[model samples]
Target: MYIKLLYSAIALVACTSARPQQLSLSLLPPAQQVFVQPAQQNNAIEPSINAINKPTNPIVVAAFQREALLPPHMQNSFYKNPKIAETLAQNSWFGPGEQHAVNRETEKIPREKIFIILKNAGLLPTP
Candidate 1:
């Protein structure tokens, strides 16, 4: 009972006698004058409504054209078996129309992994 009363008294004193510390407002050197940005100013910004001309895109071609391979002997040797060539072409990467597959593979790479790649590639400074 005495301990309880002592604790209660101490708590009451702590609560009642406690005063907020006064903050010392020491005057310092005046801050530099601010330059307000023009962009932040409330002004009527008219949107650009100019007619956009359709850009002429270059025609995309096959990965390997008939005449692309140089040296006739090498070309002939490579093209000896048409069936084998066709099968290999079907399974080969960097072939024509493989952009969709590349894009799918690209999506599989996590964004976090790109940071590590950039660090390894010396593109981004290590944090």
Candidate 2:
């Protein structure tokens, strides 16, 4: 009985292992194949460093349009009144007392004093 059970287990394992391995090669559809060709070669054609430096994407330009990442006061005004978007853009630094207002709101040390903190936190560019 023991020998029979051992032979059956071995046979089961052997039978399972003997099956042909599945080769999962997913062929892209004709449209996808054509679309992917250009994208695949996109990085291969290197542009001049100057060309690479320029922001070609409109989305990126639009994102940074406000400048200084919108500061906190501008964000409040923007949510309260959409018209403030235009107003904020005209100002050099988003809003009146924005620097001081933000400084007062946060408990964190002032940016000037937090140079080491910013560097250690990976927020500021390292020298």
Winning candidate number (TM-score): 1
Prediction RMSDs, each to the true structure: 28.8, 25.6
Model 2, backbone clash pairs (residues 3+ apart or across chains), number:
0
- lDDT top scorer: 1
* Candidate 1 lDDT over residue span 26-97, tens digit each: 211113223232232222222222112322111111112222334455444554476875676457434556
Tens-digit lDDT track for model 2 on 1-127?
Answer: 5655554454334333321111112222222322121222221223222122442333223223333245555543332453664464345333555432212222232323333333344444544
27 Cα displacement, candidate 1 (Å) = 58
**Candidate 1, which ten residues in sequence have the lowest lDDT sum?**
20-29
Evaluated against the true structure, the overall lDDT of model 1 is 0.33
TM-score of 1: 0.20
**Stretches of candidate 1 above 4 Å error?**
1-63, 86-120, 123-127
TM-scores, each model vs. reference: 0.20, 0.16
Query: How many collisions per candidate?
Result: 0, 0
